[model samples]
Target: MRITADRTRCVGSGLCAERLPDVFDQDDDALVLLCADEVPAGLRQDVEEAVQRCPTEALSLDADAPEH
Candidate 1:
């Protein structure tokens, strides 16, 4: 899995970082940064939640396996 942020679309909501700090980080602009691409060993749920909470739809995850 790979997580990335579309800076062009990010609204600086920080929702992803607040909800999943382990996976998401924010730049000075408040846009979330991807801590890693692959979904960590056991943080799938958190990642999903973050994606869902992204106000600007800027946070996106690409998983080798469909989200389960």
Candidate 2:
């Protein structure tokens, strides 16, 4: 799956980063930062959870997208 984060929509909740450090992180300003553009096969579930748990709806996952 492909993971996208809208930095502008981020509220710096750190939920995504805290739950999936491998795929998400916080910048110096604490806004959401994507550690990877594509989600690994094994981490799809975790990425989906992060997207849903994002307080500001800044995270998105495209399961139909082709892998890089």
Candidate 3:
């Protein structure tokens, strides 16, 4: 899975960073960065949790994931 965040929609809640530190990093501007070029199997659960935990719905994953 490929993770994404809508920078414009983010509210700096930091839930994504709390839930998925490996996949998401918070910048000084308070927007989270998506670190994964390709989803790693071990990080999938945390990635999903981060997406779900995003209060503004800013976090997302590509719906059409490439075959792993």
**Candidate that scores best on TM-score:** 2
How much is 38 displaced in model 3, in angstroms?
A: 2.6
lDDT of 1 by residue, 1-68 (tens): 77778889988888888877778889998876887777788998888888888878887777664654
What local distance difference test score does each model get? 0.81, 0.88, 0.78
All candidates: TM-score: 0.83, 0.89, 0.81
**Candidate 2 residue lDDT tens string, 1-68:** 77899999999999889998988989999998888999876998888888998888899988789755
lDDT comparing candidate 3 with the true structure: 0.78
RMSD of candidate 1 to true structure, Å: 3.6
- Indicate the worst ten consecutive residues by lDDT in candidate 3: 32-41
lDDT of 3 by residue, 1-58 (tens): 6777898999888888777677778899888777775657887776777788789899
Model 2 reaches what TM-score against the true structure?
0.89
RMSD of each: 3.6, 1.3, 2.0
Summed over model 1, clashes come to 2
Off by over 4 Å in 2: 66-68
Sort by TM-score, top down from the best? 2, 1, 3
